[model samples]
Target: MTLEELFAPFGLKAPPLRVLGLTLDSRRVEPGYVFVAVPGVPLPHRKPLDGHDFIPEALAKGAIAVVGERELSLPVPYLRVGDARGALAHLARHFFGEPDRKLALLGITGSKGKSTTASLLHHLLQAGEKPAALLSTVGLRLGKEARPNIGHFTTPEAPEVYGFLREAVERGLEAAVLEVSSHALALKRVEGLSYRIGVFVSFYPDDHLDLHGTAEAYFATKALLVERSHLAVLNTRLPHLKRLLPRPHLLFGPGGEVWGEGLREGEEGLRFTLHTPWGSGEAFLPMLGRYNLDNALAASAAALAYGLSLEKVLQGLATFRGVPGRMEVVQKKPFRVVIDFAHTGKSLEEALKTLRATTRGRLLLVVGAAGERDPRRREDIGRVAARLADKTFFTEEDHRTEDLQAILEALAKAAGEEGGLYEIIPDRKEAIFRALSEAREGDTVLLAGKGHERTLERGTLALPWDEKAVALEGLTALGLGGGEHP
Candidate 1:
């Protein structure tokens, strides 16, 4: 497509330069590529990263044209728009052939449980004999093939997201489940895509406060997803859910369109009879956290709304193993060592409480808070850790350029308020080793924060980190579990 042809939809006159591809990153700009200069987060000392500054580099790299928020005279065609990110998203949609028009799309959004819910929907689609793709925190799955997504961004930039969707459509996939993040909605990363069903799992006001500036604004941005969706699948119990979405929605909870009865949780997992408008069936979710039962129902409602049978939904639920780092059990023999991606206060509380119920011995916790996001969450996390766990290890978790000692001390103070046994461990690996080494038979060690993340940010360095692998190594090195993985 030529530059003029691409911008014609926006009613803008452009040069007839042929465009081969699109990119937000100037580093990736190549000859014939249309570069969109989107602003990025600021580094420690550097000013807020802006694509405008890199236009020269992009042009030098042989970019045919540049689209940015700032108006500037350049050697190549320069189109200035009010929202460059939105323009990028739209142009990416156009460039990718608007795959959403060809594929049924389901968007799962909220503070937590998005990955599991999206995964469940993908599994249900496959179980119902509909080939689909999934883009979630765990990984990307198209048809029978799957790959781990190692990045921290749950929702990638517009180009990559649309590119993945286009690939899915090309591979003859009929549907896709996308795990939407607040940043994605706020930045117009998913501007042009249409969602057949938007799933609301759970929301934490404190989550992404650093990005949205206020809790009200955070929720308002999140509400945009359901507002754009053809149907919203929401939890009936969350009062805020009904308020945010007024359109046609499927509520999954007591007295809602989809509800569960005869719920049971044990060593195996959860078993509940799911009741929906279309049909009803007994469902068993092979996942921990009874709270996740609602997530399962949310996914079921989305699938049922997407034209899947209740039996297939239940089948997928039964066969679906939980996402990695989400209530993931690392070692199970002597003492249960579980690694989870529970970072927020609500999620951490839920994880700790759930483990407490199953623990015959003391409940051990190794938890930490990230730096530069929300300062209030550190207090919440520390208080929850101390109030619940028998013993808590306050340690480092993505403390990028922040004083690790101060963060640990803040946790100690919060734990002091709870009058619980707690110790500050600066090194994350050491904290895991200590937690595992001290755990006794029947005690469950919950490793909270940094689930499925391949890197740990401390100062400016993002070092390699694998929570489950580190826990297993700690167990083996401690001469506790068998040398081989459990």
Candidate 2:
């Protein structure tokens, strides 16, 4: 493609020159590349990262032209625009041949359950003999296999997003399921793409408040996906969304278009009778926990809206081994060990409550909150753990460059307020081992946060770590099993 063709659609004039590729990151720039110095607000720093700062790196890396919000004297061609991110999205869409036009997109968004719902929906669609692809917090899946995702962004930047969609089209994928985040929508990472079905999972008032400034703004940004989609699938539990989005949609909770009845949790997982607009049928999930029922119902609703059979959806549910680190069962013998990605207050409470009820003896928890985000979440989770579990281990969880002790103190104070039994362990691996060592027969141990994640951040250093592997290591130390990862 040529520079004229890429920028002309966005009303920017540039010299006609061959453009090999498009990228926002200067490190990825190559010969004849159009580097988008997209100034972004990914963090809450007083001095935000401006793409203009990376111009020299892009030039040194052989970037043919620079597209950014700032105007500066450059060695090569430069185009200044009001919104560099939006322009990057549009130019990528143009260069990628508008791949979304071919692939049917089902966008699942909210603070939580996005990755699970997207995975479930992709599974259901493929069960119906349709080609599907997925982009989620867990990673990218072209088919049944997944590639480990890089970085912490749930939704990656526009260049990668469009490039993936372009690849999905090239692979002849008929559908794509994406886990959209509030930051992605607000920052225009998903710009210029319309969804066939926009799904809204449950929301928490305390999630990502650091970025949205208010719960109202955060909720509004999530609703943006529904604004552009042809159909909106929402949870009836969140009735306020109906008022915010006045458009017609499929509600998936009690008294809604999709509902689950006779829910049962067992050794085999969860089983229930699922009701959808199309029809009702018996459903079985290979994953445990009642909280997953909501994820199942949400995915079923989107699949039904997408014209899949009820039988196919149920089959997909039954065959799904469940997403990694999502209530994953690491060991089940004298004591049970579970690894989950429950970092938020609501998720932590639900997970603890579920395990607490099933525990024949004590319920022990290994949980911590992330850094550089809301502190109120840590307080809420701490209190919840105190009330739900017999004992809690307060430990490290991605305290990136922030005061780790302050974060732990917030949790410890909340636990103390609830009169909860707890211990402060700064080292995450040590905390996990301590929690495991304390578990007795008939007890259940939960390793929460940092689920399925390959890295653990400590003072800006992303140390290589795996929660499941660490849990197994702890189990082996207890003389129960070997350290080999199952």
In candidate 2, stretches whose alpha carbon ends up further than 4 angstroms from where it belongs are 13-17, 42-46, 244-248, 482-486
Number of backbone-clashing residue pairs for each candidate, in the order shown: 0, 0
* Candidate 2 lDDT over residue span 7-46, tens digit each: 7876767888999998888878999999999775766633
- Provide the lowest-lDDT 10-residue window in model 2: 40-49
For model 1, residues 292-348, the per-residue Cα lDDT tens digits are 888888888998899987777777888987788899887776788888999978899
Best by TM-score: 2
The TM-scores, one per candidate, come to 0.93, 0.94
Candidate lDDT (C-alpha), each:
0.86, 0.87
Q: Residue 140 deviation, candidate 1, in Å?
A: 0.9
CA shift at 269, candidate 1, in angstroms? 0.4
Give residue 31's error in model 2 in angstroms.
3.8
